[model samples]
Target: MASTTSRHQVQDAQKLYDDRAAHYDDSWHPLFAHHMVQLADLKPGDHVLDLASGTGLVTFAASMAVGQTGSVTGVDISSGMLQQARSRLENHDLENVEFHQHSITDLDTLSVLRGKEFDAIMCASVLVLLQNPGQAIKAWAVYLKAGGKFITDVTHPASQISLITFERVGRGLNRPLPFYRVPFQKPEDLQLLMEQAGLRDNHIVSLSQLEAANAGEGIMAYMTDPAHPRLDKLYTIEDADDVFDKHIDHWAAELLSRPEIKNEARKIFKEEWARLANEEGKIEEMDCVFVGIGTKVG
Candidate 1:
């Protein structure tokens, strides 16, 4: 039985992903697909399940890895996302993959998978969003055949430093930023979760990416960008500019308080904002991902 908080989380996730479905692949799918494919280790003629398989990123990769004789089933909560996944499947002319609209937290209710087992189960950057990731992992493990593999990935804590930087900036402004929920904060945490879920011989691998320089854009545009799912939860469309302005003002004020580098800091800040407004300026970002692989050994 899902708790009230869990239910609300699911509803919120569904709405967020449904709205984000169209543009999700443009940004995140490419990053996730690479790690998910390697962690899943799909074999020819294997039957695989992909939970929270958004836009068929991992599903399509698994489909190709499994060859013609194998099959892959993708499950997701957002019908909108599944719709996009189905369209992509058609575009690729993939015959061995199927998708179902279902929540990762409610896998037991899925009729198609009932009384069936899979050679592997893969989830990509999704466990952290669930209210009860442990229970969900345990439930998913039941569908795996004995000695079957289960692979999942989560954002490494080091990769989340950008959010921490934002939080600090918000605090300097005296308006605390809302922290997004991220469950697996450390590698050990995910390892323990997998063990508690009855998975054996767990392995954690780190995948890191160093992005090329970015042309920095306006803070407002960055915040309200359609691909940024957290925007709606953090600020309203109408007051977003006001909120951002306030933060920028406060941040500038804090920088100006320093005597030694005050002038330089102010100049850099002003120039940066100017460049951002004009959609120019170099920005670099990096991400670290931890992929966890375990097997259910009966």
Candidate 2:
């Protein structure tokens, strides 16, 4: 909603998530959602809103916390993700949990949500993906009842290895690449973000753990897969060859015009990924996140 570029980014992100929906729960993503829900400390009969609730991770957790007296509404932009969520919902008789497909930025425009208020609103692992997080927070606060809380999180700047490496490689090449923004470098940045959004009495908590990650294979897929949706913004995928020049941006074409430069860049990207691997052929993934909670001002 901020600009044409922002809209395109959101669309491309939706595609990326849709592509990731099937295997999303195979990782530790659900663990963070549950932890955030615990920090929320929901009470029975409370109505909760989950923004960008992919696969109902937060929604289902909050659903259990709030119990049968309350309801949880999960909203997301990707239909594929929501389909997976809805299927999971079928396995459990959670009448209090429901999912809607809608962009979080447009929540205020929806007839069902326009005048409705929530006891708390939670957005997990999604703040950095927004084009204007502060603006989105301000809009979301309007739907929170007076004194209600808004809960969200920002991961440590170096949290996701493959993504960080992707950005680094793009910077090295001086080539334009679409990447998610990492806005919070420390707890104070998140506190300031909440304060600026008109939230009060902000509380911040840190969660961290070290885990093994297959960074080598992940980065390789991004660099080599022509059909990868992560490159949707930079390339046109039409069953084209893997050669970078044929489908990638003209800038990529210009770079690949020199065969030596192309090979050098490719080698650098691959070696960087390899260099990150440990003795077990995996990277030590630092899973760090800062959860921020703030009450809506009256």
What TM-score does prediction 1 earn? 0.68
Q: Model 1, range 177-217, lDDT digits (tens) per residue?
A: 33332445667788898999999999777554433235243
Where in model 1 is the C-alpha error above 4 Å? 1-7, 162-183, 211-286
The number of clashing residue pairs in model 2 is 0
Q: What lDDT, from 0 to 1, does candidate 2 have?
A: 0.71
Residues 3-120 of candidate 2 have per-residue lDDT tens digits of 1122354675587788899999998788778778877889999999999999999999999999999999999999989999999999999999988888898886667787899999
RMSD of each: 12.0, 10.2
- lDDT, residue 224, model 2: 18
The estimated TM-scores of all candidates read 0.68, 0.72
